[model samples]
Target: MGAAPSAGRRLGWKAGLSAGAALLIVGIAALARHRAGPPARCAPGMVALGPRCCGEGQRLDDAGRCAGAPSRCGAGLSAAPAGCVAPGATVRIAAGTLRLGPSDWEAQGVVEAREVFVPAFSLDAFEVTEQRYAACVAAGACAALPLRGEPGVPVTGVTLEESARYCAFAGGSLPSRNQLAFAAAGPSSRRYPWGDTGAVCRRVAFGLRAGPCGWGATGPELAGSRPDGAAVHADGRVFDLAGNVAEWAAPDRPGDGMSGTHGGSWTDEAASALRTWNRRLVPVSTRSPDLGFRCAYPP
Candidate 1:
């Protein structure tokens, strides 16, 4: 038989083994806890929300998982399938200067105002309507728009790529952020396209969840006369420059795969969102039910 260790030596060996075993157990427990956290529990294409999770471009479902589309679409744009069309021709805006940016009274943080010069260009008086886009689809020059909204409303739910295609089909192009601001705010650089009207529905085609399609009304009325009180562009060409539907702008920096959207939408109640200075930079692939665009032409 092997010789036994002395009692003192045996005690020391036993204690060392016990301490090592304790440390190993602690390490295993820590690893298990880490694997059980939210980052681990969530699946691919899902993000963990408070006590739940959501999918990309989707809100939290009742089951706490991301499912379905985003909750906010432009006001008046329904989940229904239909198209929209504006009834007016394009307007020509002469080359002019526009003072863009927030007013001194409204400036916060580092936001400042600047003057922008826009070349002579032609812009549509109204946002592109579903009917206009459909014509392009029929010609096989554009993709079919998703089934939502009405024919008389501003064409919502288009990506920047789609908007560019539509403009090209119409023999025009998308306006730059600076151009849009100039067309809306003019040289005075008013607080809003319609002055400081605050959050009034009359000044902007908003507040109604469903657009003016029902009850003998117009849908997203940009092509023609609105129910009075809507702001006209400072240059006196485009309509609903501050609200109605957000319009896509040409990318400020090309090759960056990024672009900007301007104006306020019907879903927004905040006056600031509808100002001439407001700009939302997003990916070109983005599509929203309340987002649409207008076309511009060089002089």
Candidate 2:
């Protein structure tokens, strides 16, 4: 009877050991499966933040906390005083011009331009491209403007009213004629943004190659193409104020049929025609292949 009891006790100990070994094997298999599985994919519109997800275009903002929704820029909010509102905001105009350049053949054709203070604002760095304008048209924010070729080309044939509507949608207003001139004039008065030196047309201006007399043919060039010649503000904003395309400025007052346009077009002379103070005006409804606009915003 004693031997039988001892043998039973030994069998019970073996059973306990086998159960413990099985549990250990199951745990190891689970761990291996977890490590061998594919990594989890990040969701669309969710920026990764270390092993977690965050909002698009948003970072930890130095506090290590996720930024809230309704993105600050989505509902008419600006990130910085002079920063871009959103990735695709339409340009806004902040002020108007008080005077215009002379049209006389002689007299250096100085515009005697006046200054109007523009608060920190935002503008479409690129002229309204065809693709952007098309989206506007589809959204019913603007009328469909004609296009010749690539949808990436700058949108032309848009009237002042149409342009203003686009800007308003993007949280901006049409620049007064004065504000337009101030941007073109830059901080100091010089013949052009790159100064009075007789630089190459491609460098200072955006037109085709000039002949011996320095007159060039007309062609559309990329916006902000003159990277080396761009004017950089203290805030690190680079602008193609003189070369990209001629932009329309807002009209002055009632019965002011003459709307101002700034910047020398791709076909303009590199010297006198591209002066910073140079200003010209045409009818508000006038549209040209080389004419486009950039917008400004309120401070």
Candidate 3:
């Protein structure tokens, strides 16, 4: 009976040793495979290449590359998987000049412009919509900016106070005129956001016609209507800030007593009026169909 028990114990030990050895072999094989780089798999598809795995709706292609991964919009900005910027979130861009139209037009005309310095900051990707503004109003965070048309037609006719209120609710602040111009023109004193040329008109949001009465001439379009409207730098910021609604600048001018509006409205014709430095003074109490504002935040 003693011998039988000893034999049984020996058998158990051997079995345990075999199991441990098998597990070690498996682990070694896995480690070797991992060190050899990603396994041969389909390209442009998500796969469990090793310890890491891509999310659903993704696949590894024949080239062993992952495909269909969503884009990243960074902090404070909203974007879809494919990388679509939300209308209200601000986007940062490289520091540059805020160009203004020519000062030569003393009598009255669109001004040719050059670059001015602008500090780094972020700005709303889209103009504030009625739906968004309405939320602020309901929260008592801000008063409503008057609207002459549909709620979705872009909130217009808002005072600087109202604009600032919206920015505050969004956890940002209204940009001063200088800041606004810097965002639009960038470091270069280009006539347009992209450059100093008439061709840039197609890339910005402004009227196709000229003169103060030209307001609403171009009509408000989406934030990025122009193909080359704004360029995203290596740091993931966008530039050439025009082509939606004209935004209000901070530090209210007591002399003119009118807030500054930057970027061209749908009604502007001459490219000169759309320069970064182009300033229009509207009564703080006044709001127009073509007038709207975008908010800014510190980077």
Candidate 4:
């Protein structure tokens, strides 16, 4: 071996190595930060976080280079949306007018058809499922599900009051009849969710219809069973709009202790029930196996 170096010499050598390593690290970090700036804005599939753009599976961190592990958007927001993580939970619907009732459809009972303007809001892609509701109950946020349906089935046996509570727990509110209409019919006011006419064949809205379905059927099938079948909105996002279950909504007026349930259910086969203007008034406390609900967020 060569003669041992002096302590001062060894110390100097070690300092030089540390400084070089630190510079390399600094250089790499700088490059990453620089890359996140402009490219983030123009990049496809990238979301803007501050001045930086983030790629899939990466979100903006405090350091601002898009390497942070993302947290789920708590009630009122959606994830990047690989088709809704929970119950019909993806897609953002912009603010627009909800055509309350189409001119051609005949009004039934207390339900009326008309046009009403509503603010922007986001809605679930599918109705809330049994398993998600159970989780809410377990977390102390909602009541126990009435009868433990399948995990993928829409939760039923819930009263309007309970549905409202669940919406609150989910960081949203029961959709207004106006909001529901817009989601189903879109801005242009298509008659059926599948579009202007029944030319397109779609699976059961996937449940049962008990009356002379102006289609002839009603019953609980499964939520999300018909994946590509959710109705399309002109702007963006697909909705399980007129699916089997009727959804709860605050009636035209509130505080009367009366609410409305909209949409066709497994028991409904009336042509009017599936129409955009179908609105059935019910006591706020009423619960039915064929009625379920979704949450809505303000724009």
Candidate 5:
């Protein structure tokens, strides 16, 4: 005759089975999480709460979900799955204060370093390309660029008025001097778009060593050809803010008949000329091969 198992033995067996099942469930959950990868990062001015991205003034509700309507995007910007966007391949910049001058260099018209409140706006990621401008011209909104090159390259030799007209046709406007400086230097007021680093062929398309791109290149390469020259912001990247081509900004004073050209062009050889704060005044009607422009949208 065989003896029956004790009650304690049966209980112990049941406990072991339950423990094993629990351990298996935990392991499966960990593996699933690992396979799912990290959670999505929220855009600038938005906070990530679990699976929801809440705006600046939003709050969590009792159910642990984000509550409140998302703040509206600035004028000319529309909310998209990838944050705010403006017409003409632009990136949105949240409204904030920035130091708007160069602390190192002092020039005649250079305003001393001062805190300036910049409103929410959007700026083109790259200078206007010939392809985009050609569309405007074809639609009868803009005149044909005088110095045309590759379709992918920036269109140049447009007067300040011409640039403004193109911007308007593209659903934006010529960025003001302060707006240009804000986008170039950001809130940190970096000496260059990529930081304090000196300008080089890899970082800019200036006429230094050999030429643009340091390979005896004659003129500006394709727009955004110099990726290292991008001005990285929390929102996104703005390319060629310190090179590629000088950009025309709206005159600081209306009726002055003079506009500021900034960001030193491919023909600029001096590193000092490429400084974010470096600018020169020219007659609004003047146009040069190295001068181009991008647009800005209002808040």
Candidate 6:
């Protein structure tokens, strides 16, 4: 009011107000940044996920906290909520030199009968029964077969690929020819699974003078049907190594379109065919009524 403000003075007053408003806005932005703070830091061995950190193989829980994932089992084990566990009973066989086949086999150029060093491994004490294979099929891991035996009887009519699939589902692989020989003969290199003694009806289930197992067995018998047929190993005994059903074994050469069957089936009429060293080769896709298999695992 004292001589009315000059034009320049009014303009200066407006500029001062604008500068003060800009400074206030800058201060508010700074305060917001300070409240928000820097990005979250994760501890070692952990990674930041959103607003939280999770460890390896871990994820966020419903409470927004880090949690562990379900762990997977290794070979020869079954998965559970707690962890992995053995699928079934297994007999541990000590590593030893396998004197494969008989002298006659080598002489006739049937097999080399080489002395191979076999690493220690574990094997199922019994042949895979129909029930077991059926479970695998139900789980969508194995293929179906024309199963004829009872649930306790050894599974048959399974192709090599089907057998392998079942073995994998059981957390194992097929036994090698050398491994089967060692399990039957051991270090002494016995001629038969029990001993050098000949296979009789009382000791094995084979085609007898009358019929298979001295009975009219047209197909496979129950697993462990003959208790005397068991073979002693360093850790325990395995049944049906000489008869009941011929077991699928890994081929002498892998990927050769050929596979091997060890032991002998009830259809065999000759004791020589039941010897531990005796092996029969067939196409990988072959499926026989007397063909079955067992599984082997790491010791």
Using TM-score as the measure, the top candidate is 6
Put down candidate 5 lDDT per residue, 196-225, tens digits, no spaces: 775766567676225333433344544664
Candidate 3 Cα deviation (angstroms), residue 100? 6.0
lDDT of 2 by residue, 1-299 (tens): 35455787899999999999999999999999998753332233334443223344555334333344413221222333221122344333333332234422322434453444555455555566555667777888887776643333356667777777777765676666556555544445444555545445434434343532223333344344343444444443334567546777777774676677777765664455566666687887887777777666765
RMSD of 6: 26.2
RMSD to native, candidate 3: 18.2
- For all candidates in order, the CA lDDT equals 0.64, 0.53, 0.56, 0.60, 0.71, 0.72
**Candidate 6 weakest lDDT stretch, 10 residues:** 76-85
**Residue 222 local lDDT, model 4:** 43
Q: Output the lDDT of residue 204, model 3.
A: 55
RMSD of 2: 19.6
Off by over 4 Å in 5: 1-88, 105-111, 208-218
As for candidate 5, its clashing pairs are 75-299
Candidate 3 vs candidate 4: the TM-score winner is: 4
How many residue pairs clash in all the candidates, one count each?
Answer: 10, 14, 42, 14, 1, 0
Tens digit per residue, CA lDDT, model 6, 1-299:
47998999999999999999999999999999987763223323335443332344545445333344424322233333322223347799999998865543432465565889999999988889777888998998888877653455578888888888898999899999889888988888887889887576656767732353443445655465455657898688887788778999977787899988999887888788888788888998887877899999989
Which 10 consecutive residues of model 5 have the lowest summed lDDT?
73-82
As a TM-score, model 2 comes out at 0.58
Please give the lDDT score at residue 126 for candidate 5: 84
| lDDT measured at residue 273 in model 6 versus the true structure, 0 to 100 | 81
**Candidate 6 error regions (>4 Å):** 1-88, 101-109, 208-212
Count backbone overlaps in model 4.
14
Candidate 1 C-alpha error for residue 119, in Å: 1.2
